[model samples]
Target chain A: MIQKILYNFKKYKFLLQQLVSRDFKVKYKRSVLGILWSLLYPILMMAVLAIVFTNVFKFSTPGVNYLVYLIIGLVIFNYFSEASNLAMSSIVSNFSLINKVYMPKYVFPLSKCLFVGINFLLTLIPLYVVIIVSGTELNIYHLLLPYVFICLFMFTLGMGLLLATISVFLRDMFYIYGIIQTMWLYLTPVMYDISMIPENFQTLFKLNPLYQFINFARSIILYKNIPTIGQWAGCGVSAVVVLIFGIYIFRKKQDKFIYYV
Target chain B: MKKETMIKINDVSMRFNLGIEKEFSLKQWFVNIFNPRKFKKEKQEFWALKNINFEIKTGEVIGFIGSNGAGKSTLLKIVAGVMKPTKGSIETYGNICPMIELGAGFDMQLTARENIYLNGAILGYSKDLLDSKFDEIIAFSELEEFLDVPVQNFSSGMIARLAFSIATIVDPEILIVDEILAVGDIAFQAKSEAKMMEMITGGTTVLYVSHSLEAIKKLCSKVVWLEKGNIKEIGNTKDICDKYENYTIKHMAGNYDI
Candidate 1:
């Protein structure tokens, strides 16, 4: 499977690059600030959430700066939400091109992931800014953040493939995913700490694949600690498992997409 | 020496479900899951192409002539690998550039210059190739002044001109042209036709589908006449086209059967 994906990547490298750039351009075409919005949007959201949770809800994390913690969670979760949402609609949205061309179908969803992945990387600049402004120590462990992001990207791409396939057959999946995303946001504890959950339900909450990813990011950025081997294995396994399942479903159903779309 | 076969279609067929009750929503799917009889009763199968068999040698220019529902487009799509045949197989050699619909990949909000690259990439042109051919494409399209303007503002003719220019920039081994020659004004149409003629004379194996018998006669050496998903006749362009013209005349004169 990896070999086939790599082969396709090499064969369609230029097309993929063009598609990603096109996505980037189209996203910011009319905006005055353009690409700077990617950096500013997350920071603005972080400020609002930090103020609300700290002042209104009075939430606190012992020994960890709340600003850095909130920014890390917001950045990672925002990427997950935006990437998966964009990918879910990618196939249905490109029905015109798909009907006329013979390029690989997976490129649509893959391109959305890549487009959002670049934005996610840009948003990291704000994340680093928040860390410095909060006076958090930058450590060697911070370099390991890329590993967590790769895992999250794989997971999001897999979910995107699955959703893109389903959305082709059923238009209702689009609205249904919006509801699921809202519920998923609240359940993943982006605004609150996982310790806030009763000890009995912590394992159940950890079962959410996103929790593992968000926790991985927090461990590196906010806590200044390296993730344990078990945590690393958990993120990698869940990402790979979801990605494989997504590819399997997407490949199985992609041929029917031309008809339904 | 006999030329190599560029395309071989072996008993290919395509089937589409014409049922209106297709499960397009999760609610409908769930309702049908509990009522299997409703799901089974609404199936209406449509055979777009049936038992299609043909071969085109290298450098052959083939024209397909039929009424609107004769499966000419479907056949082109299957050969282009855009759609799979329900049964049988197609063996094709060399690259195929299918101009099924012009500007299908264009993002209307993107500028004309950006669209050139985006559409070029969709047609499988590498960046370096597009960079070199960029001037020729712009020159051929005649949209140089509007390069910075978004494509949404361009007239439909301008869009078609740009699309046609980008698609034909590369000469593939097989060229699939579906009913898109009537683009832009008469002069532009003539210009595009001449460009197509150049490609045809350059030894590109062509599968041309058009409603204009005049264009077909001018371009193709052989013709395939399809009727109701079956090949009614396949022979020299003159013979088949003559027969098709007669059949059309007879059918138009209130004679339903020929």
Candidate 2:
């Protein structure tokens, strides 16, 4: 299976470049300001939320500056949402390619994840600036950011591949995706900080691994503290399980996917 | 004797279920899950093709003629590997190119040049090969000025011209063409026909499916007539085509005009 994927990757080299390039171009094509929109997204969201909740309206984001903390979690959650929301529909949208050729089928979602990944990387520059301007001290704990990001990636990819396969066989998946995507935003503790939850509920809420990821990222970037070893292990274990199950189901279901598509 | 063999499919069969008789709903899903057949499930499993076997030699053009849903495209798709046969094996030694569904690689959102590179790669062209052949493809497609524009803007004829141009470039040992060539203009169609002839003369195998019996007569050396998922006739193109025509005339009560 790995050899098959590798061979297809080599065979479709030109196609990969074209797809990535097309994605880049189509994103910025018609806008008067072009790719400036990329910078505008997180920055604008951070500012608007910061103003409404903290500095202007005094809605309170706890001890951290509403702008900085929200921006941190927003950047991470955006990556997951962007990857998953589009990933669910990746195979369905690209029926043009799926209908004709026999590809690995996992590549479409992975390619889309890469597209959002590029955006994530782009969003990081401003995130670092926010980190600096917030006057937060950096330490060895900050070095672990890459590990947290990988967990986020694997967790999202697991779900993305699962949703792609399920949606292929079931049209009801589309309706379900809309509801799930909406609820998932709140589930991840994106717009609101996790501390708002009562202490009794922390264990229950953190049981959802996605919130654990957001909390882990926030603890490191905002508080300059790494997650406890137990939390990290939990996130890691969940990530591994989700990805393994996701791939297993995707490969098994993919043989019939062309017919469904 | 050195016999030229292009493609071989042995005892291929395909069956599909049309699914439940009623529209699937959440309640129905749960009910059916428990009962396994709570809804009026139609046992609509039918073989679209059964025990289909054929072999075409190098430089031979084979025409597949059948009524609607005769499993022609399904058989072609199996040969293309776009689909796998349920119960048989299909083997081809050379580069197999299938045009069973024209513009399968095309995305209207991308420009023609972008699509050409993308589509060509999907069809198994190496980068260097496509780079050199790029100009030739554009010239064949006659879309030099419109190359930068998204393909959704192109007419179906333009799409057909580009697809055919790319399809022929494979120099495939086995080439599969559906009824897509009929989309282009008369002049372009003539040009396409010339391209197919050149491929045939160069010892490539061509398997064609077309409603135009006239073109089939002109191009194919062998004709396979299929009816209800089985081969009705397989022999010299002229002989079977003639008999098939007479049978069709009989089906239409002899009202057809010459």
Best by lDDT: 1
lDDT tens digits, residue span B133-170, model 1: 99999999888999999999999999999999998888
Q: Candidate 1 at residue B191, lDDT?
A: 92
The fraction of reference interface contacts (C-alpha pairs within 8 A across chains A and B) present in each candidate is 0.74, 0.43
Q: Residue A222, candidate 1: how far off, in angstroms?
A: 2.6
Q: CA lDDT of each candidate?
A: 0.89, 0.78
Any runs in candidate 2 off by more than 4 Å, and if so which?
A: A56-63, A191-200, A226-228, B1-6, B19-40, B55-59, B180-183, B254-258
lDDT of 1: 0.89
DockQ of 2: 0.45
Q: Top DockQ: which candidate number?
A: 1
Give the TM-score (vs. native) of candidate 1: 0.96
Locate the minimum summed-lDDT window of 10 residues in model 2 chain A.
A53-62
In terms of TM-score, the best-performing candidate is 1
